[model samples]
Target chain A: MDAGVIPISNTQLALSVILVLITGVISAALRLELLKPLLWGTVRTYLQLTLIGYALTYIFNINNLILIIVIISLMCLVASRTAVRGSPRAGRYSMLLGFFSLWTSTFLVGTIVMVLIISPEPWYSARIAIPIFGMILGNSMNGIALSLERLFSEVKSKISEIEALLSFGASPWESVRDCVKEALRAGMTPTINSLMVVGLVSLPGMMTGQILAGADPQQASRPLPVVVMLMIAAAVAIGCLMLVLLYYKKLFTKEDAIAHYV
Target chain B: MPEFFKFDQIEYHMGAAGRTVKVSSDLEEGSILVIKGPSGAGKTTLLRILARLLECDKGQVFLQGQNWLSFTPQLWRSKINYLAQKPAVFNGTVLDNLKKPFALKIKKDMFNLDEAIDGLRELSLNENLIHQDARTLSGGETARITLLRPILFKPNILLLDEPFASLDDNSARSVMEFLKRWLENETGRGIVMVTHNDIYKDISGIKIQELELSEPGVN
Candidate 1:
């Protein structure tokens, strides 16, 4: 039987609209005011994913290194800007610094994984590089945003305690050490928790996708371990870099005093 | 003239409006600068500006013939300390709180445990309290410990905002006596204590600077 993989035609895909329609109906029945957003989100998701599918197909066919680099850079820029939105009080340079952190960590971790473990032909092949970079960048962006938001909010709420420490002649770093530790922990906890129940509790997106594409189950799950490891490395790198930069940029002034937001 | 710590036409913005308060004074060695006002007269703001926690909108602060603006925050901070009204206690024992200041790179002096205990004794806190958790202490005890911990560094200037508000009459009096003796003995050490109450009225030799809210709308 050809039941190992089930392909969906345009008719089956069109039938998926019923699922979204059901959600919109429920929202209207409940007076949740979510019907508008639900409809818009459904439309956008369909259109965007379709566009991305076409774009990916073209990029993969061309296999030009320059186009891949441009796409990757655009991904980093978008991810960094999204991360910076959570830290509104962060300085003007935050977008630039955020880009640097996201790019460096994702690139470094992604390159090492692709070079050593995956070892795909033409090493920087778009098929392998783009997806791997996407996963690393996406996870690290969340971590960076969470860490920055936590650090800034903690400093604001605990300004008096920070000042108390400063009054004792403690440096800016010493004053905010506790908050920094807490923020870093918060950033890494989600990634670590996912690692705890990878295959047992959930199939995970990458492995599920591979299996759905008709890859052998054993082969499908092979890269999941490396993906998780790369996630941790990228997340830690981004979180640490964000903390260091945020401490220098948002937490302190030119005179090394606590910034006005704090 | 430069030997005295000077606040030259210092102005701090209280809000978006034209609401601003100005304070110009010179704090000489061994002098007590008592900033007197009701609850919302920008008294804490004045002390914060002095502590370098709040930057003033105008003017400059000079200490010992040098512009404090030119000094590093570490240098300015080590010389001038600010005590909050409610006081802040970290998650640790009293001894741990007292030892933290010694960890600062600028504070190279050894942690003087005996001196800390004796100072706490002056504030009616027993030496045994040093081992107890700081967060579990009462309001008065926390205030005393907060005051005691920073003085161990022997900062040149103490910017105290309602240091005695949390204490009762007797405790406040005892604390005042201890502070008086400490100030009299230490020639260059000075204090700027702000209070809504006149509890410190009996203490002599303090230069009173009464503040009035510039904006009628301010709370």
Candidate 2:
């Protein structure tokens, strides 16, 4: 092993220490009124990350396709649920839709880019699967959160106009026309910006990690960058598309009766 | 006549400038009812309750002689036009703003754009203004955009909460005149307005009734 290279475990430990120091400074500066929440957040973040690290160690040992899918599906479900809960009146069905849309869209596109185009992987295996899937899930999670919250609040704040539309003989779509447009705009803006700033502003975390593990900067960055790029673009596209689906799936029941479900 | 919109002994409670104002009133179909009182009189609250925007502690609102609580809020709201003083005019061209309300499915097949434009012309607004962003116009202009919005929906009742309060004298006169014609065309569409400024007080053709938010209910 090269002395210049650090083990992944040591690097992970270094990250945890840095995070604690950063939290200590931020908590002190903000002088948070709710110390309990801050404490909980700190403790929970540490425990969650540690638990995931341990769990992945076991999961990575298994080579079953069914197991890989089951684990990823669980991750996707959790991410989607978290996304829906952030919105007011979002429904349980929205989780299924958001999870399916985000996962399939990004996963399909990410695989195409990862294997065929950029760093070729051997039939969607774990070493490649874990990191790429993580990137997709993370971006999709943020996108879903923003769009859901924005869509709900937009409808709520402009409620008078919505009522006016209803009175005007507008269908539900007419009432939420601007809301769809605005939510899409809000949801996609962040991912669009990150894409715009990829190499210029700073080295992304994944790329940095890959390089720390003695991988060449250019070579190590190949798959990860392609993955991030696709994930971000897909995040925007999927976020916009899924929110609309989430709106339809979560907002209305089978009877054409509309409620603030999502 | 099938009552387009009706409220029967409805009670509403909402914070007005800090204090909660309680209102209990009822109105019949096609009747021009005025909610008259000083500032912070809970007039808007009563209007909001009927409009289904403000959920009350306890009460019943009937639209088209049907219990309001029975139907979904969206269905109930679609049947009534609730226009506030500060109309939400998007930062888009006037055509976009005017055509904005038509995007709803309920109003999709219900409105005529040519008639809407003619209605604009009736308000003394130019056709060219339609191409400009609505924000470029004055508050009165914005109010007109909102007023014309319900024209597409063809709501059974128009709930105006001081629709013309901020307009200058000439604009107010023009707006009221436009409203007069619109009301004439708006058959079975009851006009329920709340205002301290009685700009339409002098209009002799349409009957008008005013009620103050009195004791125990007046905030």
Candidate 3:
């Protein structure tokens, strides 16, 4: 085996398809009815990743600041849409709120990482900024989604208790304080748990990728994961906080009463 | 003089059919306004609207000559409290539930432990019940606790929705008596309650006015 990253040829990539074929065979044998989705998902994975791979290559060569920002903004928009899509109760207000939260938090953390920490030449280099922002955006998207979903569901389930507090003249913030706390906890729990068990439980994807791409294990294992983890933690916290703060207002009417839809 | 504790042209949609109910009424100082209606008549809705917990399609509420919009909802609610039919028993001890209101920034009054204990006594509840987990309280106990919670906050008007629904004859009678005394004890206080129970008729020495709500579009 070569020391540096060995490029996989089309023949080798075709050979990898056998693994999916084997999984498809098992699905057929068990009558699990998953073969259709399995094959479809494999195709989508290949197409999407190949497209992104080519796009990233072009993006890296261009490295224009405006282009990088536009791509990152587009990524944030798509991520925000996906984040709030699963939560039906989140309403239309959440889409805008989710987008703003994701954009703000990801950029805030991404700027810190790209400028002060990684300090890649040009600082906004597409190769560094796009991938780093992508990672932060992905994690923060999941966190915001989970927290927003939890916040809305908890508010729905605890409407009576919330109204009981409101009846005593508690402000909207006071009434939903407990629910907000629960939501923030829910949002951050996965990130915190990952922080606790990273490396021990599972090797993070970026570290493994770097190591495979010929970086030394020691170098791959240190600053990359540390900065990535810290960036994710910060982005997730800021995203979840912004989401709840903005979204909680939508749960009440102008009169401070629980909104009828809620 | 401006009418005390009045709501006019209060309208809200009820049920999936969107039947609209419009209500107009007032409560005199130190009196009881018994809201009488069959089920689904928007009795609970009326109380909620008055409490500003639910918005009315069209209405204006006035307290002590001031419009509802003049005050913040928090201040409006603190002055005119609404107790739900199914009481909200929070986690922790009954005392914690009692003290919960005072923790609000809007509340200026301190939680009076002595008054709370006396309130429990007046409602025929055990003083020791204060230390028990509020979530473990029986339906009747929960109802009384919720009622006591708003009273301790000292709202000028109490909007009650079937407050005696969970209580038995004895508990119901005692609660009614306590409410009667509560009204007479304060010069400016009043109650606008929704109750199908006839127990309020038995209480003497306080003026009780009745507002009967008919089904929407029927009358």
Candidate 4:
């Protein structure tokens, strides 16, 4: 047993199954019908995390820069795909725009944190780089999805207002400027709200995990502020990139008119 | 001699049912063209297409013999204004809503409070309404204010969709009369509208265009 740390064996992990058994029993008693989803979710989470854990362990040992880049690229690609699927009306350019924005913003912030701030030995160390990049991309993906969804929906619902601005000789950008602002603001709300209540209401996972693993409370809290700031920057960057790449013209016809469905 | 405004075979499709609409029309200087139709006939859609808000699957719109698309959207809209059926009242005073058009690049004139008051009077709205919050205004007042605000721009063409849909008979008459006079005084100006009311039926010198959507062997 490592000092100040407790590692769970397979037998100990099996004991944790009792919690799930109790939940399933409650679900059955209530006839909640949530048991299937609960079991499925638990099983899926275990499998996914275990697979990723193995992959990370391999990458960390290999310590090859190219492998790290490939893994990061894969993460960005998957996140972009999720964002594009979430925002259906973002049109044909959604995938490309989503990919570009996620990759650009994540790498920009990830590089800054890895090279400048953390300055880990062998700068691209998988331990620090992977987790940092994952957090940035994960949070930024949610913001991008939310903003893109809001932008398209707002434009669809408020087509008349937008067109009114256009008919008054306002350009396309001028017409939907308010919508863009609103979407960006909406995207930022989650991160901003989380930041507001970070330590008071709930301990963030990273900070809690560091504390549990015998890191000094002060040292663990030191990176919290920086991590939160990086998340916000990444979110804003991805949101703005999506906004810039979106074509307001596509929402209209050749005659410069609004479309029924965006 | 090119017509002031010309559209040929303007078409649009709606929903999964693929219900389609096709329309063609022309307007000369000082002309009033009324678009009339039943629900789902795409009357508003046609006006939207003409206004460049909605795209026509297949069609051509010409402004003074040049393709409408040739002009930038802002330039085209400067010449042709589209008023929605339900006007959106921004979060501000009535005066703010009225003055919003001036914020556009094409509007070079300064805001004239007196002119705006006079315009409001023509719609039977009180001069004091200018200071009132637009979001708090009644539906009829909102419609009147929306219609009047764009007149300040003095566009060559005005495409209105059900402008009178929210107004009382008296207010509708006042607006109709004001529009008639404005058309007469403003030379080469035109109006195209989709309406469900008979307020304009007796108004002399106005042409009506109806769209038929559902009946077999009819259009």
Candidate topping DockQ: 3
Q: Write the per-residue lDDT of candidate 4 for residues A1-262, one digit (tens) a residue.
A: 2565657798887788778888998999999997888889888878989999998899999988899988999998998788778667656678788787788788877887788877889999998889888888888888888777777888877876776787787877777878877778777788777777878887776877777787788988876555656565665566555544464556665555565457
Candidate order (TM-score): 3, 1, 4, 2
lDDT of 1 by residue, A29-117 (tens): 99999999988988898898899899999999888988988999899999989887977776666777778878877777777877887
**What value does the lDDT take at residue B96 in candidate 2?**
75
Instruction: Say which prediction, candidate 1 or candidate 3, comes out ahead on TM-score.
Output: 3
Docking class of 2: acceptable
Query: For model 1 chain A, where is the 10-residue window of minimal lDDT?
Result: A240-249
What's each prediction's clash count?
Answer: 0, 14, 0, 5
- On residues A99-209, what C-alpha lDDT tens digit does candidate 3 reach at each position? 999999999989989999999889998988987998999999999999998998899899888999999999999999999999999999999999999999977779988
The 10-residue segment with the lowest total lDDT in model 4 chain A: A239-248
lDDT of 3 by residue, B1-219 (tens): 888888888888998989999788888998999998888888998888888888889989999889999998898899999998886778899999999999999875599999999999999889999999998888888889989999999999999998888899889999998998898887889999999899977777868999999977542
User: What is the Å distance of residue A180 in model 1 from its true position?
Assistant: 1.6
lDDT per model vs. reference: 0.78, 0.68, 0.90, 0.78
For residue B118, model 2's alpha carbon misses the true position, in angstroms, by: 4.9
Task: Compute the interface RMSD for each candidate structure.
Answer: 1.4, 4.8, 0.7, 1.8
lDDT tens readout by residue for model 2, B1-219: 545555655554445434545554545554677888766557777776676665666667676678887866666666666776776776578777677655555445445768778878888888777788777788778777778766556667778888777678888788777766666775666778887666777776866766677555442
**Candidate 1 TM-score, true structure as reference:** 0.90
